[model samples]
Target: MRSAALSCPFALTRLFSLLAHDQQLRAYMPAQVLLNESVERVGELDVPLCGQLPNDWSTWGFVVNGIVTTIFVCLGIVGNLYHVRTLGKHSNSRLTRYLRVLCIWDVTLLTCTFGFYGFVVISTGYKPWYGDITYLYMVFYPLCQVSWTGSMFVVTAISAERYLAIARPFRKLLSEARSVTKICLLLLVAVMLINLPTFFELTQVSCYDEETNREERMIWLSSLRLNKTYMLIYRIIIYPLTVNFIPFITIVFLTIKTISVRRSAISRSQNTQSLSPSLPAKQDSGTTAVLTALIVKFLLCYSMPTILYVFEYSENEELNSRLIDISNFLIVFHSATNWLIFWRWNVNKSSRSLTQSFIFTKEEAARLTYLWANTRPTEVGRDLLYTLIRANRSLALIFANNPPNQTAVKQPRDNATTNGHLCDCRLSESSRSPACEHNIQLLAKVDSHGVIVGIFCDRIIQRLSSKLEQQAIIDEIRALGRIHYSNRVPMRNTDWMLAKQYLIAKLVKDECDIDAEDIRIVNKFASFLIHEVKCGRTCAIAAEASVAYGFYPSSAYTHA
Candidate 1:
């Protein structure tokens, strides 16, 4: 029964061949001899369909694909690893957590698609499972589809999350980490189920060729009626709609909504500021810029691939093949470039003390002022400020207790290391004021707090002294001035001044009992030092004043 079932197709193919040969013979005969023939007989010839290779296998094509895949695999691995590590450290925000998961998905998808395909291309000169019903087709194809679909779904989820964050911050939808995790898990399962048909839609068949007297094996869709219908629906409608059309629509809509919300926020802020002329308008330009860049890159990378996949069943086989290759390349490129995007836009640089100080110099100061003026005080900012103050105070105490020795000091002449003394100030023979001497010891502790303050002050002075423009300094001062006024609870001083006063108080409190007079002295000293620094006094003058009241300055300074 099985043999008969297999032979039926070949028998029909032979009958069709004979009919075609007879029809050709009739074509050479006179038209009058065939005048009595029925119209259907001459209208068309029925042809038997046979399984065949999807394309002519090319060695060059396989080689190029293999090389490209290898490059992508390496880049994807390295980039995703970096992204995971970096983002893991800053996963406090909802967007950051989503991004971390997105990185994971990208790595998985790239490995499943390119890594597996690369191995196949290197081993065989054919693509797309080598047109066989092997493990590649039964397992790998479905796995690749699931990964691809899951990635697209995750991208859409990210865009939606951004929209909610920017557009509807007050809404409680998927705001919790647990909710996000649940949704992601559901999306993964849904995508896997959607792609499950891939495993069964394709199969291997034996084709008997009478002319060649041989049996050829080919990979194709199963001939069962239900399977054929399912394949047609999947190829023509379901896959394209699910993977491309819906995802593209969702992402575009969410991105546009997010932009609109941002613009509205900016406009509202400006309007409010206009009403209160003294208030500064704060625009979240950083967030807007990052989102815009991400949207543009996403469109560029995925649009062509989506279009190609939607029309993949077109009659133009060669055109479709080329498009598939191009789409695959684009997918690889997209996966590989995500790490760059995250690094450029998503990574936080605010945790490093020296770098944060440098970054906050001028424009950041203005931004902070604008933020405070336009928006209500946020606990997050306040907490961060407190954290910094605590860290600095701890550092100051550590150095005061464990001062570096003269022999251990290097670069004593550097503004960060000495108060105009080229030699290690600890080794100075001349008597010095306790204030000046303490400042020198503080400077000697470069590994502790001096480096932080020095780098910040140096960058500030560099930017302020540059010939290009002074607007940056003016903006920073304006922002600092606002901070000084609005911080009613922390004393009416700039954040920097407040930090200095706190440090001075900490140092003085340990030596003597806390008292109003002591507080007054510390405040006075902090004000004088800040004034000197702002007035463009050299590091030496500021250091001298910082330690001047308690002791005497040396008669002569020595160079290290």
Candidate 2:
């Protein structure tokens, strides 16, 4: 149950084995001292884990164990608490739920590591008195095992869920809130059962403390430590497998698969875009870089501990002890500061690909552009982009509301899924005029997979004088884009790319000086806005946004 020592349940067995041959704890004691631990010769070594008069928080051991470690634990606790509170337990996003639970478990691990094993016994210069420390440590041992193992499983669950979201998208196993919660809870119970035997690892015995020169109540290694079968199966095999090996393999596998799938999708998207040169071709490299860094960190930090758990140094106990500290420190640092890693990378700078598609795949983004050529009042798909034009209230004024010069041609595509009508949602050269409400146009090809790769949005960047104006326009378009999509299914792909081949022709089209970058920005902003708006927004917010976008003229700029 020595987590700080990479959980060597066999260490106690090793102690007993040495005792049988008349080798004592002090006989083979290393020059180095331990943190929060006590030892004695054959008989005295059976004393409690902690000394009665433990080092004060401000004592000599305080530098490494007192305020600094305490600060780290406190930060970890507060940071995890912040995540839990900020990401509500009932949030819709499955990622949010996973992160929230992860924060909870991380907090537990931090609390236990700091609480029970707070002070370090750096030196053996002083003869410390042994007390009843065995029962308390054992009581919290199960809790540590639960939290430590639980955190790993939750992370694996997250990786699996994300992989499913991209690779399958239709699977609901780890996608739903209730299902995810149940899965997390089930993992907790499994780990608890696995560590259930550790609850009996502590033994109570009356031992004499040389320093105090009196008999003291001590609880150390239990009788079960001598059971060969129990030691081999329970401690050597089950504990390490549950805590490190299994989770490490799972996360690594899922991450590799996810990256492979992502690369395949990107390759397909690039191929699709090659046929249509106008379509925007942008990959979210930022997400890739960030995820790769995180995965590398995980592999490096957990690799040592996983190895040391199954096979400790049989001959060199000192080396084993040193590795234990190193492994435990790595684990502690990784788990506690995860909040910072996630926030620094994910929360602050989100992937621009999200603005293009809900699935955040390039292939999907290419498809979405077709379904959303442009509806009445300038829209992409079913969403209303904005109330761009003002209507006459006094009179029933009617306008042609120009139809985009859409030319649909039947074309056979490379991919079977992308074989359908090729749509061009732009004004013909002859129809180009200044009166058009939207000079901007889009061109796309359609298959059952929505837009696939043919759709190309033509946006104009000339009207906006400053970068702020362009951003405002994009923001406004996103704000007004809050509308329900009919063909959206929770699991299955919708049939709409070819449902209305004529809709592309029916869309409003014009001319613009905008390029591919502008189109990508528009799509990216649209995607970012989709996740933020689940409900309706007030007019005040709308007005504020409009002013920010310079849609409304200031008093000084307004003319009579």
The prediction achieving the highest lDDT against the true structure is 1
List per-prediction Cα lDDT, in the order shown.
0.49, 0.47
Q: How accurate is candidate 2 locally (lDDT)?
A: 0.47
lDDT of 2 at 385: 9
Cα-based lDDT at residue 284, candidate 2:
44
Off by over 4 Å in 2: 1-68, 89-91, 120-129, 133-135, 272-295, 312-318, 346-560
**Candidate 1: lDDT over CA atoms?**
0.49
Look at candidate 2 and tell me the lDDT of residue 265. Answer: 82
**Alpha-carbon shift of residue 131 in model 1 (angstroms):** 9.2
